[model samples]
Target: MGRKAKFNEGVIVRKGPGKKAKKTERSNFSKKLDSQHQKHRARKRLQKIKERQDKQKLLSEKKKKLDRIQRKELSKKQTEEESEVESEEDESEEIKILPSKGYSDDNKLWLKPKQKWIVQNENINDDESDDNGEGDSDTEDDHDDVNNEVEDEEEESDDDIEMENGKEELDDEEDSNLKVENLNDLSDDDSDDQDEFDSENEKSDKDVDDLLPIEKQNIKLKKKQAKDQKLADEEMQLNIANQEVFQFPIKESEEEIQSLQDVQQRIREVIAVLTDFKKLRDKTHSRSEYLDILKKDLCTYYSYNEYLMEKFMQLFPHSELLEFLEASEVQRPLTIRTNSLKTRRRDLAQALINRGVNLDPIGKWSKVGLVVYSSQVPMGATPEYLAGHYIIQGASSLLPVMALAPQENERILDMSAAPGGKASHIAAVMKNTGVLFANDINKDRIKAVVGNFHRLGVVNSVITCMDGRKYPDVLKGFDRALLDAPCTGTGVVAKDQSVKTSKDQQDIQRCYNLQRQLLLATIDCVNAKSATGGYIVYSTCSVLPEENEWVIDFALKKRNVKLVDTGLEFGTEGFTSYRQFRFHPTMKLTRRFYPHTHNMDGFFVAKLKKFSNLIPKSADHDEVTEENVENEKK
Candidate 1:
């Protein structure tokens, strides 16, 4: 038999595995019942949640519908009211009558018809017509006739009222005349009373005035006596103070006074030592000592870099260096160039002198140049300047165009032209006959060129806005070109003092590279040996050798161009050697102006001649080779 199971309190029991199996089945059945109950509860909860959501959605939609219906009703009511008001206004206009001539008389009291009664009657008629569509036209006509008769009667009544008012006015006039007569009599009596009162007041016032003078004299005497007594007391006190001071004079401490005197003497001596160059030189006594003295002097006296002093010493001798330092410290005079296109230099000069402006010729190089010594009026805003009779330009800036020497009927390019100072000068030199391509990179700056071109009456010029270095890609074969490349502006420090510290070595390198590119592009754009002797003028307002000679040196190696003489007689030759850098030997042909020597801002100008048969390198061959490689890959 299978294993038997014993029961604790029952009479019979099943034993072992079967009994345990039975118990497990019972437990599983109970668990399934519990699971079913839980599932039913969950389903009921979900249904309740869904019902609540549906109710909320229905409520919201109903509210929105109600709001829309209310808005429509309100709008309809407003429209109906507006229509009613419009109809009432129309009815009133139809029935309204103009005022009669009798009512218009000034003596008559006019009565205006009450518009409210007319409006109320019209409204009642409109309501009655709405209740019954058919209305009696004859009745309306009769009512209008009655109204007209009433108006006629009212006009007659107004006429009678005006007649009565006229009579009343006549009576009032008569009464006013009598009243005026009585008022005149009363006024005469009042005048007599006032005369007597005035006479009595005048007598009283005369007595008071006669006594016031004596009283005033007595007060004046008292004030004078008090002032004299006060002055005498002050004089006596001053005398006593003076006597006390004379008896016992103030004494300064001898040591402190002597120390102060010594301090003043030492200050005077130090000032003398600092000012006297001979004393300073004697103290130094040698080349190294003098070098140290110059470094300190440049720093303290000029507020300049010691490096600049060293470089200047290398360029100039000791005797000349002092003169250069002195020259750089002074202010430069204002210089202007007369526009020969509009007026002669002599005539402009005379006109300026008549207006109290002192003038002097700048140099023998430019005949139209004038240096303004003094002026009572603003030179720039003068009638002559506004009329474009002259261009305000630096004397140094005129050198490049003079070196270019563009002739009439020849095409020329002024690269980097802005504010058109030099470009306009070129046009003037060309006599406005040639096609001068005035180009600038900045769009805003180009507007200035256009304005100046128009002002100066330059008809042969065409303005183009483009980079100077990119001129080679778009333009070619110019008779002449002026590339006034941008630079560090160190040469114009006297005019712009901020330039002294605005740039550094890195800035010089950047300017040098840009000038090189622009110079190369300018050479490529201009013809080398045209019938009119094509040439390119490269210029900068920089004093640095890197931007001047070094740029030329680099271009000479890369291009088939030769540096030629700029034919500027006033400036010195360019430096072939600067520090460790040695430039091309032909760089000496270029011109460099120094402020100390030339009495102008330092400038550099190099004239270049391109070879006649020269050609630029091509990039087509590389492109073709790349295409072949791609075909092979395919």
Candidate 2:
């Protein structure tokens, strides 16, 4: 139907000689396939067999490891149980060592066997080697014997026993093969062990001497050790007690060293001004003969061979100043006291130069003068002073005398004048014609003032060492007076920086009291204007308000003295009081001349006049203006 299906029915059914050939080919092919399948099956069987053998080998190794672990665990448990028993025995032995009625001390003696065991344990680690060069093999044999005994025991499962037997047999075979070698090694090892045991016994016997009797020997040893330790500890404690805590010396840098050297140099220079080598040597030589002159002289004066004058001379032997160091010479410095009334500023300058005393006019107070340091001659010892050319006054100190404006023959009092500086100047203003009563509380200083008066050829002067407060009670009819009170000298710190460090509140309070006392003393000296119409100048070298303006206010409250403005055309106004003038050291023309500014001393001055009328003039009694005051609080 489908194109006759290619007419294959009879062809497909054809069997005959072709059928026999096909059957033979088919049988050959079947044989070939069977051979291939057999080869594959053979390979699978070989692989399975190899895997089984490997698994058996692995199981055998695992079983051996587990057996070894069980044996070790058993041995560890046995050792721990043995340790507990030994510890309990040791405790019992310790309890037995306690003091008994028969024993005088709590000590015990060890039995010989006990002693030997303790000593052996102390000195040696556990010994694993038996008497052997064959020790390892012997241990293996012992293990195998134990395994065989374990196998013989009826307690184990049948399987375990069989495994144990198998292990024992394996070990026995190994032992048999090594028996002859082991016997020889064992014999050698036993001989060595005998020698070792004898040697160990001898060592133990020798060591026992160090541990003879546990009771007495250990107690004495422990006591001795305790004493030694106590002594050592005591010595250590003593050392700690005696040791001084040390501080490192601060190392100064070059600049600091230089600064210290400079300070020392300045100190030496200042000290030199206070001593004369010639006078010292004269006093020494005149006092004694046959004495160690140099050493004794040093010991008597400085107690060290470092007196400023001597040190300077030693350093500068050939210096021109050496002449002044000679015993016969007298070295003195010049002093210039200004005369504002008579000598004009320019005329005074020329007059001083003509007199061969170098003079320089101080600023603002052209009336005040200074002797030039360049001129080596001593102006104090000059003939001009004898002839009343000048009074050796401080440059800043001349401000008050100028501010006071005393007339010719006007009676003036210098309340605190010592060595007669301003008093002599006041006398010069009066042309040595008016009476000037110069008073100082220090009697020792009166001689100095007298000497100054004599040198200056001053005539209208009287020097007294009475308290200034008693001046009104004694004799007081003066046109003017100066109360140069003592102060804390804070303003002078620039000239001497040490003052800056030295000042404190305590010092200021102390100075405050002193200033008040001095002011009171001065107030007592000034006469009411109706009586001599006198005035007073209050002054100090202090910058503190308590010693300056406050002191003035305190004086005014207690006395009839009226504050007077200096009317100085040059310098600035003073503190709060318009009448009083302030000269700050830092300013150009102030009464204070600080080292940083004018290289001069610090000073303060206030001028006042006693009102003659009962009721003071409103203009004269003007309150201080706010602009004149330093608004910042002190």
Candidate 3:
């Protein structure tokens, strides 16, 4: 039909255009090569996976075998030791019970029943005394000590009186030899002097006898006072010396540096300096210089980056910053929220108490909260937990849901709900009467909500996985919205200490930008004209103002919403102005909870009442997004 092939090297061309050229197709060789390459890759991938799994299995089995051998050896050793103890017991004579004085049976008398004074109250101190069987012995010993002291004093007084009487007799004989009829007037004068001396000596003797017992007590009191004064003086001197240490005291400055190279003592010295800068730090150094060194020491000690330390110092006053840092290191109380849908708080607490769970109601501020001080059973694996009677949640997590105040039959949306804490709370508050859409971006995170919702029997929840920024397109017009945005987790450092060194300024900036975007989307998604409620609760586990106040301020100008009280009974009022940044005066309506002050995670909650759906022109954000929405739809 057409001219055949051109003779150019390995190129065949259809020269005539009689028929439309067919689309070029891969050669059989190339197709076969691609199939072979794909098969090779798949096989290689499977082989690598199998090898890794095999290695893990081998390691695990080896570890189990070693553990089993160790356990058997330990059991054998324990049994041998126990058997040795039993054989020794069999060979030894019967043990005799000794008296409270630790008396042996070398010359023991016949046994007789003895009386012990019964304690009327079960005070711990009294119980300890009774347990040692020394209650009566201690009292008798005290009485004996007093009697001995009195007897010793009486013996000394009697010896002194006899010595004085002998001295007077010798003096009288000497006077009788000297004065006779040699001088009659001298005798009268000498006799009068002797009578006066005798009268004074008798008066002194009478006073000594009267005050003999009390004098010993006075001496003992004086000794005790002297010891106490010495201790006080030593403490004062030590404090002064501590104040005079160079930078800080850790053996020597060089040794201190060497000690600091080790983590064990570095943190100790760092905390000491932070707690008592005036006393623990060198007096020669200026406060500013001390703080500079302290900042570095704190970073090294607590494993924090410099930026986060500066951020906290800026947030709190100089004195409270250490408190906040210390609080971050301590664990928050293990708290659980009772599920009212299934059980009452009283009944649930009773059931847990019966199972040897040491618990108490959390505080007056909460009706459904319980704090678990100790537990014989794992918190998450308890029968009551499996039965869905309660949830182990942070006390701070309860605040956002409380602030949102979800009502019955009202549509609610948890824009970033995962693990379903706040969402379940909202569902319970609504009594499962209203629809709740719990959406999170991560599919893996959404899986957690599934377990919680099922366990808690939450019926009115629709779990969705999508970007919160794109929430408005699929689900619009929520009666109320809760945005517990992802944050730097500054408030929950106690729960996750890795946040200290892992976070940076860039992280804060990234979180700030994300929070702003999410807050705008949250406000836009809520139905401002709802009859019952048009509230949005914005909260974060971060105490940073950039993630909290600044973001809230941004929303205030961009959306038609005003700040309102959270209705929570307690929390520090949000900062109206921090450092150089000033926020709306009504920012006080927002609440802050801190670990140091409130004994909870550092949290911020703000309730905003949306009056209208219209956004401000200053928010070119909505305008641009709206145009994009139209373009995408078209």
Candidate 4:
């Protein structure tokens, strides 16, 4: 305590020295304040740096958004360009390229020519018996015509013709030498007055817009200018065409052409099946009876008798087939094939029942077929369709598969299996147990076949995309085969109008060759073994003899295939034999369902069986004779 008191009171230094020490302490404190101020300044600089970064970030974000919008616009433009290119490509691809298949290429179907009989006016010469009488008759006819023409010209000269017959008559006969020179001056005065009145009326209408502002006035002025220009153009046309219209002599052929049109209109009035070539050749009926029957049937089904008559005349231009078509009874109880691929027959029937579609099952020696009545509900849009349970097929389409009668566990080939209607049916007939090689030349149609198989729950099918002619090489020997040869679907003309537009003899011939080749390929697939040898069904939707019988005959000679009796109720026995079947549009209980007949699509189906070991020993070896080689070289 004593040392502390001495330090506080007695250990005092000199005043000057204490003052120097205090100054030093104050200098240190001032140095500390300077460092604190420097630190605050650094913190302020850091804050300014952070603020500048944030501002830059905001600008970058705005720029990014603008860039995104520009990119979207650019992308949209690119997409439009791509779509345009794709559209052009699609348009180009729409034109079908003919395949190199020799069959279809040779058997191209052609349209029936517009047959015109040259009228060989048989004026018996006999040095022309009684030439004076003929000459006098001709002169008298000319005199009568000239007199009538002169009278007509006089009638036209009378101004009363216009008053009596109206403006249309005056215009029609403007070429007649009526001599209206006196009326021209009056017509010109009337035209000038009309133009002046129209201009005055236009000016009066403009007053309503005169009070408007300049912009509005300008808009109105543009519209008025457009209207006035159009009026002036029309007036100019009228002034230039003031001359009278001309007339020409009425032609005899013109009258005939008009008559044909009238006949067509009359035929449309009848609603009968007008195309039954087979019936036309029948010897049992009279021509008048045929015509009356056809007329009656047309009247029964269609409302337009005139149209039916016209079509009848056009179809039977020479009246050779008219009697036959008229007499032939239109088929009853139309047959509709069940698309087994999409749906089952039983299921479709039930669905139809639910939809109030009256369907009656056709019986005896047939697979699934039906007689369905009309309905307000569209059958195509039914739930059964969406479920892939059924396809609206033709009874004739069912014929080939039924004829083949595919057995379980057999390998079969279907050439040209597009739309898979028949392919799926064949699978069904095989009880979904056999291996099916279904092929089509068209790749786009492949999807349809696959879809059909999927819907049908088919498991034993392998779809291939290739021309049917090449199928023999790809798929070797099959147990059974079906070649629904591509023909000019003449049998189905009743359903599609476009088919008729392209129908011709040349087209049928092309189809014939294609059918023959397809049949040959199908025959190759047929096995010549087992107790019941394999069968091949060669079919077409064609009615031409060349495409049908001629093709079958050729195949018979080439492949030694025997025709099997179809035992159908509708068609007459085939022209060649009972083993072959023919279904005419006019026949009863057959599958050639014409609109005028059963109100159904036209179709044809033929079934043939391949005998075991039927191929001759010589067939195994090449028989290229010198003559044949020469012919080939030629």
Candidate 5:
């Protein structure tokens, strides 16, 4: 060591290499570990955590014991006689254990457990307690009691917020003997500390036991009673917390949440409770108590997070939110479009009708569309379908092509066309006369487009697999274009339930960014002035304002394009302004369809006329804007 030090006295020393960690040490679990081994490790980990919690509890109890002893000593020095008299009075007071109505000796009012006052156990006897497996009957009883109250005559007056059925001071008709103490300190903070608190109280009780005569030997019985009382208190506190926060919120102003996990009118009832909590809730309950119940209910019923629920709440009115959620739970009606290039609509309808399919013309606005009410044969596998008479699609899917109004013998671009539903619709409208470029980024998806084109007998279309955003670099100057942009699938939750919990704000942002880029590319690909068409119909199967209005507004600012009517009929007008974002007054020309209102998948379609071909050099979509959105149409 001395010789090495002499070699470089002023040189800085280098750090040794990091020690290698085993897979078990570095990661939570190893792939090599079997299921049984993993479960054993988890049990051991939980045991260690429990030991630590017990140690902390003992330490806290020791500190509390020391403080209590000191307080007793100080009190004795001030008033020894007063302390004796208080103990005598406490000894005289009896702990009468009642399993039923909680009336006092003189028949005073009882303060029920605010959260679970409605739930009661008619058979909570000694035998039931011995079994320890009959507790579910209690909750079942509570459900029946709440249901009865909900079905009773509606509350006309705003007075009884605490569920009093004309009983002078009683909070609820169902009551027990959970000592009617102060209801104000009903916080869920110390529910887990009941054991520690009970131990401390029992120690003090033992001191009183030592002073009593030997003839009165019911000390053990008293201890058992004390333990039972503490158990009831702990159980009551847990009932107040996460036992389906929606369970009680199920009971609302008009109806209880009921089978909906309080989901049905649960939305309307929650809205009513939230809007007027002061009139709906008791004086002791906080506003968060109601909201937490609503959030938990929404999560359980819809499989969405609290953040997404808040976003939906902000977008729709309190009443509309209910309709929207209920609609998402149900399936959308089935519809299909006739391939004009392959067969006539009347001929196809007659053939399908003869095959035991119950269907009707979609609407007066669409001649080639049919709404299928019932189909005995598989709609996708029928002979007419294989011959390509109609393509299975949603009713809302027809709007964008109708808006585009593709003409025969004109060049057209389907910027994001995949699976060729809309692209084939476009080709059929043109009667296979024009050159149609059906481009999609995904190669696998374009296969479906090609298959549809061939089966539908669409002769005048070309397919390419390239990113839609790069279209301006590869191709340009089309007579008309359609960008059915990829989106968060917010409007189609009824079809794909996974979207309920899977989507969030980041998904929304990602979709909006992509839509803005693709829409701009679509405008760039279309000619400013064409004899037949100079339009781009932008669309998505999404209802969010961010993915719909926000993307269109951003494109308007970047490209020389103006909004035009979708040209068919019957859809809610797009918002000219939303939250802090504003668009030109003509933004109303865009159309919006909803599952609840239109009985279709949530959708949006906007037709824009390109006025010039010049594109802005640089524009960022990340900026948060707060522009004027005043006097928006209802």
Candidate 6:
């Protein structure tokens, strides 16, 4: 402000102590220009840096995505390889290893000579022929050729004999000129020959007479009987071939020894012959033959699908797998649990026995459970069953309620209760004094639940058709809860063979998810604290580890629960690990009933105790989020 500005020749200068100073207006303008340039440079630099950062970020994200995809592909490849290895191992284990020897020819039962029975039809007219005879001429020609060849040879021999006799007569006449003796001999010979010819003609006439229509019909009936007999003999041979066990022959030279591949080939050939499945590619084969081939090709011991067989071998040892295969081939014994509320065990046993039902007590663990070894009448239609004195139930289905141990005057909940076997058992155990809520998601199945409950004289049970997973929100404080969750039914394959092919790995995963939901809901519904601690019994009619131990593992993490021993000593311990999955160590306390080991359906039962009343935080958040979304939509 104190210095005045002056300009000269497009330049301005001011006097100062040290040197010429520029004018304030010009200097200020130049400074402003410089500051603007600096700011522009800084903005460009910042923009370049930002662009570099964005490019790097994009590259990083792309690399991360590629890594994820690669990881997934690697894992999938590993899983496939592992599964292949496991299957190979299972096959090597299950298929009986042939010794250094070849298959035995000891009995040669499978090599029985084919027998062809020819039923001679004496009444068949040589002149008669049916219209279809042209098409079947090959078969008929075979018979005609045999008969004509024998008759032609016999006629030629008889002519030669006659020629020889004529020569002998001529020689006798020439040597001895005794006309009377010769004449008498010729007459006798001619008479004898005439008699023989007459007898032959009479027999031929009789045979022709037997060729009438009625006689021909009788001959055809005999042929039919002969054909049936041949078939019966063939069937008997096949049965013997199947029953006779043979061993492989040992060879001194190891180089010529039969390997597993050769043994498998031999087995396949034997099975094909036994089952009459010779032409697998034949389109005209029956369904039964096709099914036999499919079963034989799938496994050496069982008719299970490849996946199921592999899983079974993975789950059990070779000996147990054999037992399981044998057990699955036979029907499970019909078992009944007496309704204690309706009849006592002793009385029901006596009543059933009187009704021609052979009953054997199941075990010392259950007084009311009876294994029906034989029943003359339909056990389900019997008067005792109709009167609710007893209810037909699988031995495995009774384990959950036995583990539950419901008391009188206590509230119990059965989640996913349909066809109410376990629920009825629970009610009977409670002596019909407690309130039992039996719930199912399906309305149609609920009808069955109601029917079974009514038939079993279950008075305290209340049926509801609703999703069991929603029960924790609407109902609470049940003294005990049973979640016999719906599963793939791998356990009851003995009863329902279709289960072998009806389910797959995806179905198991779906069941696993549903079971987890139902289990969590059951935990919430049961009382947390009681005089007698509240219990939740989780059961599944499946032998799959994903549905049993893995589900328990998930519940242990998500819910405030702990597993306890079910006090059942009949079954083996639960699986602690399967494949890549590892379960809690305490899961061993759960019980696994195998059909081969326990003489029951494959079943899994886990008894859990809830010590905390706290609700899961995730559930609350989920509910809140759902409410907010609904409100916003409205």
The numbered model that scores best in TM-score is 3
Question: What does the lDDT read for residue 50 in candidate 4?
Answer: 90
In candidate 1, the residue pairs with backbone N, CA or C atoms under 3 Å apart (3 or more residues apart, or in different chains) clash, namely 4-15, 5-14, 5-15
Q: Which ten residues in a row have the lowest lDDT in candidate 4?
A: 107-116
**Per-residue alpha-carbon lDDT of model 4 for 1-634, expressed as tens digits?**
4544444666666556565466543444334445778899999999989977876675566457546655764565456445445544333222112332222211111101101111122443332223223333433343343333222222212222112222222222332422233233445454454345335444322232222244446756787899999999999999878833211113463254334444454343322223453432245544554466445434443322434343444443434433334323343345556665556678778878888888777665455787667765776677776566666666667767876778888888888899898888888777788699898888898999998788767889999998776676766668778887887755564454455345554555566766776777778767767444477776677655566676676666677567666545554334452235543322221223333443334445566677753554454223423333344354
lDDT of 2 by residue, 1-634 (tens): 4665666666657457765466544344334445778889999999989977876675576567657766865675456445545544343221111222322211112111111001112222133111111222433443353333222222222223233332232233334322222333435444454445435443322233222244335645776899999999999999988954321112353134334344344334323422544333334233222123322233233222323333223322222223322211222223365554345557666765776656565554454566565554566565555555566665656667776676776777888888777777777777777688889989899888998788667788888898765667787656777877767755444344445335566566666656666676566666665244477777787655556666666556655666766645544334553224543322222232232233344457666677642433443223421211222122
* Better-scoring candidate (lDDT), 1 or 3: 3
TM-score each candidate.
0.51, 0.40, 0.65, 0.45, 0.56, 0.52
lDDT digits (tens) for residues 15-133 of candidate 5: 76555642335556546756888899999999989977876675566557556655654564346334334543433322232332422222223222111232233444443233222
Put the candidates in TM-score order, highest first: 3, 5, 6, 1, 4, 2
Residue-level lDDT tens digits of model 6 in 1-634? 5976655656666757653564445444334355778999999999989977876675566457556655765565456445444444333222111221222222111111111112222332332122113213433342343333223322322322333232222233234421223333445444454355435433232243224344546755776899999999999999987864322223353245346565445444444444443443344545455344434443643446667766775676544665777777777888898888878989998987898888789999887899998988998888888888888888888889889988999999988788888888888878889699999899888888888888888899888888787788899999989999989888888788888877777677677877877888889898888766589999998998888998899888878899998988678888788877788999889999877777788899999999898866777547644653454354
Ranking by lDDT: 3, 5, 6, 1, 4, 2
Poorest 10 consecutive residues of model 1 by lDDT?
Answer: 110-119
Candidate 3: RMSD to truth:
36.6
Query: At residue 254, what lDDT does model 2 achieve?
Result: 19
Query: What residue runs in model 6 are displaced by over 4 Å at the alpha carbon?
Result: 1-301, 616-634
Candidate number with greatest lDDT: 3
Residue by residue across 248-278, what tens digits does model 3's lDDT show? 4344653446444564455445556767776
Residue-level lDDT tens digits of model 1 in 47-148: 989977876675566457556655765565456455555555444422222333322322111112211111113444555344212112322332343333
Error of 4 at 600 (Å): 4.5
Q: Candidate 5: misplaced stretches above 4 Å?
A: 1-268, 275-292, 618-634
